[model samples]
Target: MIDAIRDYWNHRIHDLEMTDQPVGTKRFFEDLDEYRFDKLHYLPRLVDFSGFRGQRLLEVGCGIGTDLVRFAKGGARVTGVDLSQTAIDLARKNFELNGVNAEELVAGNGEALPYADASFDVVYGHGVIQYTADAPRLIQELHRVLKPGGTGLFMVYNRVSWLNALSKVMQVALEHEDAPVLTKYSIGEFRQLLAPFAETSIVPERFPVKSRLHKGWKGVAFNTMFVGTFNALPRAWVRPLGWHLMAMCRK
Candidate 1:
């Protein structure tokens, strides 16, 4: 199962559809970064990618080192690990081309991290747990590597989200839905997965944004009708139905 997941990601880079620049080039990374921030505008506002200066930060499954680079630029001593060597290679190129440095960027399994206990000041696994073969085991490893009172930031898909319902209604598949392992968790289920943490808070985010991927009438309806309608609703009432469940954990 793990091998299948790795092989799949090795061939398919996340958000590859957003860029036409040649892979591993500076333009490619820049395009991806721009598109990512545009789509996930809430990420930097919520994650404080610049707050941990001179601190040790580890990002598990850090695809192409996008967020990792941001942390590094902000003076965090960053290391990245990914299941796909292709991702690691591209990440290294991204860092080199951007004139930043990482402590390390190795291809490794998140379920069994290759570090001593309490080794990092922060551990991050954004959009990673849902695709792992053993989500609980990966969470355990993340907690194990964090120093006392260290932080863990994670994001996963919400099964009870508006996007999920819309996808089903429109008969459109979610990105990477055909992967070897893809799981979505309800709020209660996500909380249960982070039981090892001393404290945890889950925030529902990634609300309806205009589509850059979808096309035709379905896309038009989503962009014209759904986006406006959903955002127009009282946020308090629709907050729980957000597509991404972002968790902040303390060890």
Candidate 2:
């Protein structure tokens, strides 16, 4: 099962790379600050990476190495591992393009990572854990690789959120086959999963405009309803009701 998924990802990334173009100069500048803002907003909420500076950092499932680039540029000696060879290639290319030097970028599975135990000061995976067949084993591997007091950061789809339930209805009842399946979790479930190796905290946060409305009145209505309901909530409440969940655990 893992091999099949890895193959699928490799093929998919290869295809994406063939047609890939850098985010245009204008759009890049506009979006650049937003990513930094997001990092700032979420970093404090997550674990502190500042203390881990000069220590080894490992990123799992680093698709095209976007965050990997950020980490390397931030000054930690970094290595990025992915199951997709195409992704590794693109990540290496991205490192060269961005003038950031990663310690290494290699192809490897999350289920069985290729590294020594207690090898990293921080293990980071953004939007990658939900796709795994076994979330526990994957987290265990992450734990095994972290040194004492090291931290791991993960971002996953929130199942309890309103947006997720709505997406399920639209996908099943409305026959939206193109919609992605997001594995959602309650705060308790998330904490339980990571309890083996570290103290855990789950921070729920919403990402506005995850996708655009499709076409007609139906799409517009759905979009408006979601925006109206969520937009008025206080930022403090937003995390618990948000579409995405982020967890930080210290080993």
**Considering only N, C-alpha and C atoms within 3 Å, which residue pairs clash in candidate 1?**
none
lDDT of 1 by residue, 1-251 (tens): 99999999999889988989988888999999999999899999889989999999999999999999999999999999999999999999999988999999999999998899999999999999999999999999999999999999999999999999999988999999999999999999999999999999999999999998999999999999999999999999999999999999999
Q: What are the runs in model 2 whose C-alpha is more than 4 Å off?
A: 13-52, 172-182, 213-215, 236-238
lDDT against true structure, model 2: 0.70
CA lDDT of each prediction against the hidden true structure? 0.95, 0.70
Q: Could you estimate the TM-score for every candidate?
A: 0.99, 0.80
Clashes (backbone N, CA, C under 3 Å), per candidate, total 0, 2
How high is the lDDT of residue 117 in model 2? 94
Q: What is the number of residue pairs that collide in model 2?
A: 2
Query: What is candidate 2's TM-score against the reference?
Result: 0.80
